[model samples]
Target: MFYGKYYLLFFISCSPFCLLGQKAVGIGTSNPRVTLEVAGDAITRDGIEIGVIDDMVDADTSTFLVQEDASNKLKTLDVSNPTGTALGYIQEYIIENPNEDWVLNLDTNISATEFVVNTISAYYNRELDIDGYATVPNFSAYIQDGTWRLTADFPSANNLYDNEIGTWTITTLIYSRDLSKQLGTITIPMNNGSEGSHANPIID
Candidate 1:
């Protein structure tokens, strides 16, 4: 009876080690293909740390985490070799005349290499009161000489008795090639003519 009890105790103690060495451990699964596999979602009270090194480094907006297929390792990528889209910068401008070619200056932090002009788009939401009717003007925004420009082809007043006056809210969306980088939006307030009796149809 003493020998039988000792054998039972030894088997119970070595059973876990034998099972670990034989097959992988699985949670919520009958079969596990890896060292440790979870068939369902898992929750980690402490934040997960990736990569081989355990250094404490802060991640920025331009930083991305990726897993390598061959090595099966996690790594961090920056804007230089970004894996996905990144948020860029934004700048705004106010112009008094839409008929004139207005030059836009970029922000100091924005680099030309970060965005392309082809991916930039501009739009405006405003209508002119002409002859007791609403009329929309042709406005355009483009980049030239390494700077953004805005222009408009507004229709002239019907006669000397008529005058055009209002404010236009123009928005520009800028992005990089392959849509990997979004440069941000530009809000422009365009003021046409003046208020009161001094208002004229002249577009300068």
Candidate 2:
């Protein structure tokens, strides 16, 4: 039995589905059980032929979303690990780093506040949090029309304090070459008044 459902044993021809059998094969899961039988040139309603089924699979899995890395490369995520799904992948990046901040190097020039990260897909019940001193902030970035752009800064309210923690996904990582290599480095405009020497990220 597959998922506690019983099927009849027979090879039948149907379109869009390929299962035609009433035999109970042991597949112990709560998920619905289905039986598929294919004879050359015959298909069924529950399952299609191997080649047709393969084509129906989506390239992106439901477990994770895709985001562009700092280098503009795509990365897969495991969204199941987080509490929210509607929140973007950029939110996931920030949640991974609570005590420290992050930065990225986009190959173009841009200001911080003007940056925005676009989601290729929409999720449900997502949220974001960011916490740090005002000097340098953690954020995301993206490339547009061959030029670099600064995305939005993370939301400070949801931040993880000494004992409290929050989460977010990062669609992009915009950092300077120097900060990219350092764990806790954050970027501040030359005129901003905050001052602090760089420190390695604290991992506990």
Q: Per-prediction TM-score, please?
A: 0.32, 0.18
lDDT of 1 at 4: 100
TM-score of 2: 0.18
| Per-residue lDDT over 17-134 for candidate 2, one digit per residue giving the tens place of the 0 to 100 score | 4452565333343333455323223324595345534433656445543445675443444544566433233422333333322223433353333443433321112233434434
lDDT of 2: 0.39
Determine the backbone clash count of candidate 1: 0
In order, the Cα lDDT scores of the candidates are 0.50, 0.39
Give the true-structure RMSD of model 1.
17.0
Q: Residue-wise lDDT of candidate 1 within 18-121, one digit each (tens)?
A: 86785789999888997778987566778877657455556633456666579756556565454544443333434443333222333223234556433233
Candidate 1 overall lDDT versus native: 0.50
C-alpha lDDT of residue 82 in model 1: 43
